[model samples]
Target chain A: MTMTDTNRQWRLKRFVQPDEILGEEHYELSESPMPTIDDEQILVKTLLLGTSPAQRMYVTEERTFHIAVEIGEVMSGRGVGVVMESKHPDFEAGEIIQATLGWQDYVALTPDDKSDTGKNVRTVQKVPNPVRPLTTIMGLFGQLAFSAYVGIIEVGQVKEGDVVLVSSAAGGVGSVACQLARIQGASKVVGIAGGQEKCDWLVEQGLCDSAIDYKKPGQDLAAAIGEHCPDGADVYLDNVGGAMLDAALQNIAVGARVVICGMISTEYMNPRPDGPKHYFNLLYKRSRMEGFFVFDYVPRWPEFEEQLREWYSQGKLKLVDDVFDGLPSAPRALGSLFTGGHTGGCVIRVADDPENIPAI
Target chain B: MTMTDTNRQWRLKRFVQPDEILGEEHYELSESPMPTIDDEQILVKTLLLGTSPAQRMYVTEERTFHIAVEIGEVMSGRGVGVVMESKHPDFEAGEIIQATLGWQDYVALTPDDKSDTGKNVRTVQKVPNPVRPLTTIMGLFGQLAFSAYVGIIEVGQVKEGDVVLVSSAAGGVGSVACQLARIQGASKVVGIAGGQEKCDWLVEQGLCDSAIDYKKPGQDLAAAIGEHCPDGADVYLDNVGGAMLDAALQNIAVGARVVICGMISTEYMNPRPDGPKHYFNLLYKRSRMEGFFVFDYVPRWPEFEEQLREWYSQGKLKLVDDVFDGLPSAPRALGSLFTGGHTGGCVIRVADDPENIPAI
Candidate 1:
């Protein structure tokens, strides 16, 4: 296969305001000559870019997460790509890989770079084997899935007979979390989503036993959670912080684990909103609330991936991807995370899988 | 010595309002006939009433904690007393014991009540050995010290080379928690207390390596904590909650453990203030925040007490009690917890140790 010489990229045009919703206006499209590889470097052609709610922090004026994207720089992101040219002995052309590929068509990577970020998932590595419908790599077995594995199983400690509650239930991490909780022996899986449509999708897709429509007029979140989890939720995975977290706190059982994987609700808010009002429940019920970054568990990613793959092959886990076609749709796809417009794991398809790649 | 035929007691006159400070006005002192023992029961004469910030919750209109006090009821409390008479084989006259004796000069106790409250520290038990300056039993070896133990050691998981922070550092649980963190080999202990005097006391008494006087005019608490814990606190034992907890949250180290021991700041308020805004740090730092009731560790109290006594005997721990003399001082002393009027573990001495009791 031949590679394109022209690279189209999205650059951060401006930082998001605290009160603003992320949209296409925050980014600008530009063109550049395809990147070239030096000795020991590999030239990669982007195939698909994954979108995370956390990516919003990259464009914030302040440094909110580990990495920041400067104005005029290619918006920082992660994606799957194929090595179109390789000067490194460990890599070969045609090999599929995943890394922090940014929102661009072509890039050069030095696999052995010693920067701190380089030591994390940001480092370039070839995808093991190859899978058709490349969106699976972005949605099921990639960073998003690893995050759900850590939040629901490791941190949330979902166990037999547990009643699990998940926020942003139809989103990438939350959707996987709901399933993992059930697979981990939860007696019931309850989800909180922004609208009736998303809530219905959560239950219909078998991700939740019941779903709370948080968008319903005058809905009392805590009461809604209580009605579903009368015995109290044994594990609560929170992706959208703010009132949702407070509501979950009110209904947590003794020794409940509140896993904070993300705070999409308050991420863009400067002088962030006041925290959960009922966090005191942590003490009252002798419960625990912990937060984690999936990146911190990179060393154990393989362990999580193996189990998740086993579950998937056994029909115990499901993959759902909300794919936006082409690099031009990148900005809108990322924004859809916060807008609650996506149905599952959100990804932008930059290119189709090469013919030589095998299906999983 | 002959016991008085009339018993003096304090009853809950009214529940407290959200914004009002606790004081004598919320209680009424009254006279009653001395209690008599029945089969398997004991009649005890109250020696001292140990005060806790949690006592304020007992008088709140809404039940915030496990046990509640209703209007016209003798206020519930824990205290050390002498076994004046016994109808059971296990007890004898002149033996010292501790139980939920309430705010009264005499109380009738049924040690094996089989009720939920009886399963906890509220169950009457003989003091292992009588100690002179009986306030020691009320402070160093009682529920307050047990709370500090569970918070700093079991929950906060304070360890060698760790920097620990304690809120309300001069109060009952905080004072002991500070010392426990030090004994657990914390590299540095920073305390938050209301006044310059209490802050000074925290450092002078060797309870903290340094103390932040939160009452200082224009004091920026988060900044103050950052100055003392430049690398961030590894363990934060929060007794006051509210803004103090938020400030501590802002300055926690990676993997920090925030132990919620109490929320004295908002306990009396009908509507609690918003939670710590910077709780998101829990995720950014990959930390954990947990809360516990010392009563939940009832099965392990003896294990905690053993280690505490060993520390006390070795002079690695110190006892500092702010004693209020006489039954009449009970209301004012309990109020002192909120007003920050006491310097150390607050206790009300209803009567002196009987002459026949031996000193430890």
Candidate 2:
């Protein structure tokens, strides 16, 4: 492949208002010279971009764990790329890697300054050779699957015979969570998803034993959960918060474990929305509710990778993605997460896989 | 004491509305023939009544974990008493015991039916010869202190140098939790109480390094928390859950432990009030918020008693109570919890301790 001078990026044009939906106007396609690599840097050619509600957070004016996306800067995001040129001793050309590469065609990961220590030190990690498709590496066997593993096994502690309930069940993290719960010997896996199609799709994949279509008119979600999980749920992996979480709270069994994975439902609501009114159920049922970030468990990724890779190879797990073609499709793909317009791992395919890329 | 036909009891005359304050109209002091003990029953003379906001719950029509108080029935409550008569093998006369004796001078404990298993089997426990005063046994060394022990030591897991923040800091559960957190090696303990007196009392006892009078005019609770817990709270033991919880939520450290011990603030609200609006902070800070009932930790009582008693002996822990005189004082004492009128353990001193009474 020949090196190109033109590098196109989806630059943040404005901060997203709390109540506003993301649009093309929020970000603009800007052309610039390709980023240069120093002796300690690696230039990466972006392939697939992962669209998550977390990406929307980067565009906000509020201070997050990392710096917010400023106007005229490439919108912060995560993507898997191939190393096109490298000066870093730890990286080489043609290697597949993953990092917070932003909404850009190329990412040059520079070395950390002397003051950078531990998590402050930024570096791209080489993607392991896949047992499944390379696209599955980013969706199921990679960051998406890694998040589910931490929530289900490490945080939720899903044990044998546990009845697992997942909100946003057909989405990126929830899909993997449902399968991971089943593989870990959950007696029943119940899923709550929007629309009849996603509900049917979840059960069709055998990811859930029962699925509740939350988008159905006049749906009493709490009653539906009771109908499916008569004994009440033992573990609830919550992604969509707001009213859905309140319904889940009512159906949790005594000593239930409610894992707070995400709150996409209320993320964009303006004047700080009301929280789960039934959170007192946490006391009444003697249950526990906890929130965690996947990065904290990064040091233990190899342990999760070993088990996940084995499960993928044994045909015990299914990996799927909702693909949006081309780089310009990023904005709509991300918005689909909040509106429940897409299922599985939402991926913006920036480019096709390189020829004869051998599986690990 | 001579047995008399005059069995004075406080019976629920009517259900107290959520917004209305408790009054004499809600309960009536009725006279009835003393309860007759059957062959498998024990008759007890009530002494001290432990009043709590939870007592207000019993009078409500809604069914909780336990049964609700019925009209014309003695109001459900917990108290210490002397066993006047016993026909059951497990009990005997003249022994001081504690049980859900209700707001009555005399109580007859009936044997459980064969089908009655688990928590349905009700029985009284003999009081140990406490190293502290007998009143203190029911307040600090009994259910109240046990709940605090489980929350602070077990759930919150207060470690050395941990900054502990407690809400309702002078109430039954909160008072003990504040002291217990300090005893567990917490470096800085900040308390949130309703008034200046309670705030001063919390700091005067040396239970907290700082105290925030939440009721003070123009006081910004979140800012006060920031001022006191400069490093952010490592463990937050929440009793009054509402806006105070929201304030504490905002100031939690990266890996803070939030122990939901009670939600007295919303227990009386008819429509069930909104919860902590800042609960999303759980996700941002990667913290764990868990609620627990003390009964679940009954198996670990001795573990708590050992530490509590040792601290009492060493004068490292101070146990205090707000005393109300006579039987008619029960309703008012319970109401005081909601109004934040009384601090420490709200105890209704029904009668004096009898001499030569052997403790079990």
The best candidate in terms of DockQ: 1
Task: Give the per-residue lDDT digits (tens) of candidate 1, residues A11-68.
Answer: 9999998888989999999999988889999999898999998888888877756788
Per-prediction TM-score: 0.96, 0.93
The candidate 2 chain B region of ten consecutive residues with least summed lDDT is: B113-122
CAPRI class assigned to model 1: high
Give one digit per residue, the lDDT tens place, for model 2 in B315-343.
88877788888888888887788888887
Report the Cα lDDT for residue A153, model 1. 87
Candidate 2 pairs with clashing backbones: none
Q: Write the per-residue lDDT of candidate 2 for residues A1-360, one digit (tens) a residue.
A: 556688889998899988888878798998899999888888998888887777788788774645477789888777888889899888888888877788888888863442422443144667757443566776776677888998899889999999999999999999999999999999999999988999999999899998999889987999999999999999999898888888999899989988888898888787888888888888888888888887677777778888888898899887777888888998888888888888898988886676445221
